[model samples]
Target: MKNKYSTLCYQFKQLLNTTLCCTALGMSSASLASTHSLLIAVDGLRGDGIENANTPHLDTLINGTWAAGYKAAFAHYAQTMTDAAPNSGPNHVGIMTGVTAKKSGVTGNGNVAGGNYSTYPHYLTLLEQSNSSLNTAYLVTWGTDMQITNTADLKIDANDAVNTQNAVNIIKGTYSASNWPQGTDIDALFIFLDDVDGAGHACCFTASDDGYVNEINDVDSQIGQLLAAIKARPNFTHEDWQIVVTSDHGGRGSSHGIHAADNYTIPFLVTSKVAKQGYLSGIPRNYDAAPTVLAHHGLAVPANMDGTVQGQNIRQENDKGIDHGLTTYLPFNSNYEDASGNHTHAQVGGGSPELRANGKFGTYVKINGKKEHLTLGKPSELDFGTDTDFTLMTWYRVSGDQVGDPVIVGNKNWVSGANRGTLLLANEGNGDDFGINIASSRSDRKDIDPIDYTFNGWWLLVASFDRQGVATLYAGSPSGELNIIAGDISNVGDINSELDWNIGQDGTGRYHYNLKADLDDFAVWRRAITLSEVRAIYNNGHGSELLSLMNASH
Candidate 1:
């Protein structure tokens, strides 16, 4: 029997999901049953550092969810007093509590003068409270990681191998029939590995260092052993298990705690039957881990959990999708300057990202079908991580007589096969075809039905992609709007930080897919804007109207 509050909480969550689904076309409505969630944290491991190591098992697991890479999210989130310290204390606390260290009162590694474990609630505590019968466990190699544990069912081992072995036993129900029944299962389990961090501190943190690389390999091997053990379980096939792996901050040369990118970045991987295989689209922070696991168990994340659910937005902030996470909004009101607060300046060339004006808005960029583009070199703001959802929008009128593919906006590296960021091309050979190349290991293009845009009046083109590889493309005409499923493609890839993104031309140096049309109000959002939001923008009557709505909403 559930209490009224509990029932209301569940109902409220469902209501939120329903309201959100009504807004976005590509938004996922899939729900997971309350199942087991296993979170493994590798301390002090760099996000990119795994690329240089021999981690066959870890690599194999990542392939099932994120393709082939140790690519990752940020662990050294600056939302706490730790700032860029990247210490295990604050990171692990954030991972377990879903709150900043500042709020959790676990500011530094050592116990705060008056702060106790009860200062902030752990996600496990909340989950257990939601369902008392749900089993939970925490295994760590560092004593400091124990600070985040509020439950008595905790195990600590400084040795990575022993700690993992113990975790394997616990999963196998070998810990004890009383704590873990043979037929029953653990609802949630968290395992922390510290060898990689130890190796980094002892022998240089660089990937080239044999000691550091070897430690990573060792951990990977242990992960393989654990997976094998779980598979050997009698109920393995029947159990709906989800495995999430990440780290407690990355390291620099020999130490961390700096505000550098290398020190803050860490790998985040999820392997499960329901998991999406690609790079996540959002900027995952350490706090997101707790909510992600909680959501996997079909539990409503508490309002205090300061993190984004893996596939769902717990806050429902973008339900309306007016421009929730607007990164770059190039309204082209008068110039090529970005209206989005990021102030991402565009460089005009040939036909110019800064070009001929006159549109529903004050001015527009006109691509003259020549070797011209607007380039933004390595805009870090555009690097929506692997498996993260994002939405792209632009209003444009195409020229009918185009000799090659006309790209509204795209990255040059996409043509070079890097497939970072997004390359939106339409009017291929003619003004009817529309295609998109998402960031992936290889450029996998998804084609939508040919909607003749050649010489067509200004139309609002909105495309959104989610972690599940589902893409929805919308073509909003003055008369009416049409949309189509763009088909699923590899969702695993990151923006090529080494290259430049452009507008009105392909990333290829040859300058193919030039935009031969009038463009206005080009915007990129970190989140996948819903269909209702797209309709709202189109229904606003004019470009300025929509712009005002977006500005006002944001």
Candidate 2:
């Protein structure tokens, strides 16, 4: 019996060894790896051009969780000697090195006469320096991009077609296998498509011109081919790939270099499992790609880089509060609940408004179109004393298409009730001129330029009044960016602090017009918040989660 048991154990051990040997023979180096990345840069692509181009491959990325949608990035640069216009050389360098041309000293498209990559080490340099074994490659059409990085293992100045095939071959172990031991040896691969830029230069960027659109469509097809090749790799499933596609800068007509909005705005799309789906809030600059790529590989961003890893980093930074001068916060979700520590609870009066769940962040209150209103109970905290700085913030969506004045929030004099609060006056006098009016003080009133009325969409409204009686109104629609309106106050005197602080109704002593709007995240600050801070709130609901706590209170 002992001899029989020993023979069975030996047979089992031999079978296990054979299985292990077979597994080792079949598996590649990437099977045990964590992540890989592919960064593609398209030169001279416009923000509006993609809207006309049929890019189904890019559409998948934009509608998915990885990308933050259109107009997701900006090229922030002033005209300098090195880059007088929105040049690709400096912009691509910025994307690779994570710094602007001013800091990196690589100012123009022409290569530096006597310069080593000392000030601005390319992203590839950072990657290779961090991990010597990580394979990196850069395939570009322009020769100037060569000076940006010194650490890329393979640098090929080939056409987009050849580069695409080379990338596939590298992944398939056919091209330069001596350097890359396995088919999937490359860790990071960058491919530049210059056809679109060439097309733009050849023919003016007319939307009707097939030449320009055809180039974009052609590049999209090539990208599809590259994606197929990567997927077909033997060890594709084992490796995690973060695909990022973006443009260096946009162009106008035949030229691209200028400080205009059309030239600076470009499309940026990224795909990964952990990315959040939506328009990236705040503002994404061109240089953010380098840090983001570095972050994907679990590499630390060097302190020297100017750009930040934005999309994923926002969540982490959000955990730590960015409330610089947050005073009174009333997240209208659930109820007229104030999230700020200050007890500025809403006093429901005109009608019994109920909480609904279709709000931007959480739940919002439904103010009936009749005479419904909610007034802030404590007036001292909201009313900035005589000539004091103040700002009003809220997110609301109009339900009814009322042509009359829709008073969102009001603080009027108890005596005269002249228009001394914030009101969204739609179709007031004009058929479609929707404007905002704010009475800063008892007799002082400021009128903002009218915007075309929009309904059924969430709108962010911010009205701020400084001590000097200058008023600024910023409004952001659901899809559109923020719009600014500035004006001076007329009669800057004592504010009527004792009056009722109202929402969804014009409580200005005389008028009782109610607003049929879903209001949420209403906040009032003692001091006027900066424009950047206002933009932050509009881009990403920076502190809207406090509304959950407000909901819990109910």
Candidate 3:
């Protein structure tokens, strides 16, 4: 009798579990049907272009909430060489692999003739992971030739008008669009528009760049067509949906390549099945484009990916949205004229970075490779860990003239008689490793973990010091991931020394030096920036793009 009772109970529990799972599935289907996601990359869109053009379609996009903008920090980013060389291979690899060209071991578009060169460490698109369960497909134009075919189930050869119309038909409620792959799959579609970057290169970024503008308009019209198609499709309303659209890089000198502001800037946008969330700003790198689909389908982001969730901010969020209140009001660089009457940007911390040492305001030396002194700017002080929650942000273009990276130090009171003092952070040249100094003395050292920055051509660096003196440095995403690509995990901000604070100076007395690049948009906050805030930086609101179009030549 006892055995029978136990058996009965086990069977009952199993039956209950099955019923619950089925019920969950039903709910998911209802939401999933409405939750269709699309990721789009508009080749060569600039943050500054939005302000000067008639981008009504993008204008409708809100700069926060479902989508936010964030700036990216890359050393070298460009569009293409020529019509025959319409290759953004490294950038495309950055997208599908979520790893930068440097990190994924795929450095440039192609250094050879008629072949793909992205195979040192084979990259896995988020699609090949758990997202396999979902119907994932990549549709692209000429830009796809760079690398999309080598990544996943991406198509290159297709009739543009027909394929677009077919996609539109599927988007609308028109009998599920007979041409689409059949299944109850949670589909994530990614597409790219090559006309923007391609045309932008031929034409400069100005009112005269009508060809690029019209191309964007054409993209908008097709998007509208897709919207209409989805609305017409049967059972389409039952699936959940999200759409992400962005660009790879912009143009410079009426062309692209090399580490120029125009060539490195791009666009990222996302729209949920419901609600028009608006513009997302400040997207970090081209690689951040994929993790949305991967994370959505419950796949882990590859350890090597430099992408961030800020790419896909569209969610099924209802009721007033989460309170994403993170703001930092620090000006990057004010206007400055040189001795030759030529214009150039000043060191950002303060205006001119010129400080009076012996009671003279103009008395200052160049700490960061600048020939001029910087005043009216925030001086970088490394005495941290005092604030309960502090975050630092800066936009910098490192010139190749780098002695070494200056590190932020802690434990001020120990090193100096006053609060504390920081030693210069430098590569001991002992090897390709980095170690921290407690005192200005090399012998008085507490060896930190070895870091590799040989590949840091020029990227934005943001370091956050949490409460417990546990410091984490972020090269790409501020709140995205601690490691940019496949980098380091040293307790960077962890300082327990009684030292004084310093800026731009390293252990060897070298400065926080870098050559070949421009820097701007420096900020610091008292608290951690929420995910929503990260999205805002990607849009046109706060830090949508790093450089200003007015200073395009700079």
Query: Who is ahead in lDDT, 1 or 3?
Result: 1
lDDT of 1 by residue, 460-526 (tens): 7877766553455656555442433233444455555355666776665355455667777788887
C-alpha lDDT (0 to 100) for residue 225 of candidate 2: 75
User: What TM-score does model 2 achieve against the real structure?
Assistant: 0.52
Tens-place lDDT digits, model 2, residues 1-554: 11223434534653454467658778544445346778888887765456557777666666562223212221111111123357887778777877777676655577442234676677788888898757788888876666555678778888888888888787665665343333335678888888899998998553445788888888888887777776777656656777777777766567777654446656556667566544443345567778878888888988988777744522111222334345778665556656677677787767777788867777778877667778774367666656667787778677556646666776663233343445544434344334556564545654554444457787787776664534555566676545443444435565554567777665542354456667777777776665545656776323334444334434
Q: After superposition, how far is residue 102 of candidate 3 from its true place, in Å?
A: 2.3
On residues 441-523, what C-alpha lDDT tens digit does candidate 3 reach at each position? 33332232222233323233444333422222334322222121111112333343432222343222223342222334444
Alpha-carbon local distance difference test for all models? 0.63, 0.63, 0.40
Cα shift from native, residue 316, model 2 (Å): 14
TM of each candidate vs. truth: 0.50, 0.52, 0.47
Regions more than 4 Å wrong, model 3: 1-35, 63-87, 111-133, 143-163, 170-186, 231-237, 273-283, 311-554
- RMSD vs true structure, all candidates: 18.5, 14.1, 14.7
Question: Stretches of candidate 2 above 4 Å error?
Answer: 1-31, 65-84, 111-116, 177-184, 206-208, 313-554
In candidate 1, position 222 carries an lDDT of 88
After best superposition, candidate 2 residue 354: deviation in angstroms? 39
